[model samples]
Target: MQLAVLGSPIGQALSPVLHRAAFQALGLDWTYHAIDCTPDRLASFLGELDDTWAGLSLTMPLKQSVVPLLDRASDTVVRTGAANTIVVSDGQLIGENTDLYGMTQALSDAGVTTACGVTVLGAGATACTALAAAHELGCDRATVIARNAGRARQFLGPAAERIGVKVRITPWTTAPAHLEAELVISALPPGAADELAPLWKPAAGTLMDVLYRPWPTPLAQAAATAGRRVIGGLPMLVHQAARQVELQTKCPRPPYEDMLTAASAAVHQLDTTT
Candidate 1:
């Protein structure tokens, strides 16, 4: 069996590491790879593939673009208006969103029992998933801070409306001061987090960064230094990949320790390559 994570500039993806580890631990002869697929090339790529492709992990530009190309999608995919995982059965592609699963799992693992006010940075695809996660956690009020305020609203406004959560969009510079919340989720890219680090005050709540590649992100480090609980994005990646493996192979749960070891090794290899 074969599977792959498809995205543009996918060199940094850890999917292969986790999936391969799970397959190896389970003694399955499955292969997982990453394809650097741009949006313009997606259709031709999908058309070229046959039933040999067991599943696919979509990221970035492909997530929203591939939704219309899928034969069908789960309710979660429809609601999120994005596709992260696709399973092919009988030559038909079915789309699902494991991003939400990842976000929710990360929050739960951090012991965020009840959703309080949330300030989320970035309003891209990942931010949409974060909003969905916040709603699932019962967060009624949310403030979305984005470089492009309109884009942030475009990304999160509909989902917030559907989920009955009050969401407001604001420029990152004008984000409210003296903010109080039980949880703060940073969806910004790695470098962006560094700039936002100073603006971040040490709230007595959990601070979660969706970027895990660099390990302790600047925001996470600041939060840690301030004695705040922080959750890295690696746990979310692992848990979400576990759900994807279960969906694809009906495995109980991906062997997390093995997956983590493989992922850590992959990260080290990535560091060396860079």
Candidate 2:
């Protein structure tokens, strides 16, 4: 069977490597690749797939765009209006969000089982998932720090409401003040929060930045120096892709450790100390 991860700038995606490793570990001959796909081309691209395709992992703009094209959407996808994993069942497309699961699992693996206070940085699609993940981790409310609070409220409000999680919109400039929350999830793009690194002095919070390629992001590094728990995005990426592998192949356990090892090796090529 075949699988792929789709996004506009997909060259940096580790989904192919992660999922391919999962396939190998499960002893299944599968092909997974990265496809540069924009929102405009998603529908047609999904339409052109043959029966040989099993599933797909999505990144960035494609996550929300692919929701409308799905024959069925999981509850998380329906609530957040985003689907990062798609399962091809009997030629039907079923949308599922392993990102929320991956985030919760990542936090759990880092010894954070629950968070009373949670703060999310940036209000993009990933931020939506972060909010839901925070809720899953026992957080009833979350603070969304975005460059534009208005845009953040507009995009993230309904999702929060549907998830029954209250969210407060705050300007991104105030991000440094909210780092003391039980959990701080940085949903900003790679390098978007680099300038904030100098100002980051997290107070007793676990920092989870959702950018793995350039591991130990500037903000995360600063938090770690302060003796705070810091988690890179690789764990979440591996767990999410592992769930994708399970959904695609029907295997109960998809060898997540293998996936992590593969992803770590791939990122090590660029940054050795991940």
Candidate 3:
């Protein structure tokens, strides 16, 4: 079987390593690759896939873009309006948003069981997943910090209402006072939150930065220096990809530890090379 991760600038993705490790451990002769696909050309790309294609792991611009093209979507995808995992079963496409579980499991692994006040950085599709994860972790209210207040509110307001999390949208230029929360999930890209990192003065709790390629992101470093519990995105990536493996291969249980080891090694290698 064949599987792949689809996104622009997808060369840096560790998904192939993780999934290949899972297949090796499970004795499955499957191949996975990374493909550069954008929103405009996604339809053409999907049309070219043959029966050997088992699944596609989406990232960045393709997550929301692939939603309308799927035959069916999961509740998480419907709730977040994003699809990260597409399984091809009997030539039918099924979309699922495993990112909800991904973020929540990453938080739980970092010693966060439940949270009250939450602050999420940015207001993109990943931010939506963060909000859903926070709600699942018992966060009743949240404050989203973004640059475009209008766009942020327009996208997050209804999502907050749907998820039952009272949300307060704050502009990035404003002070970072609203950042004081039990948990802060940074959905922004690397170096995007550097300005707020030094100014962040949260009294306590964890900060899970959803970026692992660069090792200690500026935001993550600042949070750690401030004595906050810090966790990277690798844990979440591993868990979500493991779920995708199960969904694609019909494996009741994939080799999670093997994937984790492979992902850790890949990240370590990247850190060393950089």
Candidate 4:
């Protein structure tokens, strides 16, 4: 069966590598590819596909746009209004959001305690996922910082209401305060995050940078130097992709180690290519 990940700037995605490795380990005959599809061209892109496509992984601008195109979706997808995984069954498209599962699992695996505070950077779709994840992780108080305050407030309002977390929205120019929370999740893009490093520091708890590429982002490096625990975005990426594989292939559990190794190798290859 054929499966693929779709996004505008999708060439950098490690999904194909991880999914291919899982398929190989499970002895499943499946091929996965990444396609660069922007929001304007998404309709035409979907029109070209047929039933032979087993599944699709949506990213960036398409995550929200693809929702209307799906025949059905899980409750979480409806709640989040976004989809990262699309399962094709008998020509029907079923959308699901595995990003929350991935982010939640990563926080749990990192031993982040319940009822803690969380500070998240960015107000995009991934940041929304992080907000949901923080709530699921038992974070009662959360703050979302974005380059644009209006956009941040808009994206965070519904999620904060649904999750019942005290959500605060602020401009990215304001430095994040080290409050009572023990975890800080950087959900910003790589370039933007690099610029924000000088203004932020992880105090007493773990700092999770949601960028896997470039290995350790500047924020992570700064946090590490400040004697704070650090978690990379790779764990979330692997876990989320694993959940997608399970949903698409009906596998009981994902081959985690194999996927991680493959993702690492793929990143290494990318580094060499550049």
Q: Higher-TM-score candidate among 2 and 4?
A: 2
Q: Write model 3 residue lDDT over 32-83, tens digit each, in one string.
A: 9999999999998888888999999999899988999998999888888889
Residues 48-153 of candidate 4: C-alpha lDDT, one tens digit per residue: 7797898999988898888888889987787677899999898788999999888888877888656377888888778778777787877777888778989777
Q: Which candidate would rank higher by lDDT, 1 or 3?
A: 3
In angstroms, the error of model 2 at 251 is: 0.3
After superposition, candidate 3 runs with Cα above 4 Å error: none
Tell me the whole-model lDDT of each prediction, alpha carbons only. Answer: 0.82, 0.88, 0.88, 0.83
TM-score of candidate 4 on Cα atoms, chains taken together: 0.93
lDDT of 2 by residue, 36-83 (tens): 999999999999988999988899888888999999999999888789
lDDT of 1 by residue, 1-274 (tens): 8999999899888999899999999899999999999999998988877878888999887988998999999888877788899888889889999988888877787788677788887888788778788888888888888889887677678877876678888887865452345778888887886865666565587888988878788878877776678898888888888878878877886687888788778888877788
Each candidate: RMSD: 1.7, 1.8, 1.3, 1.8
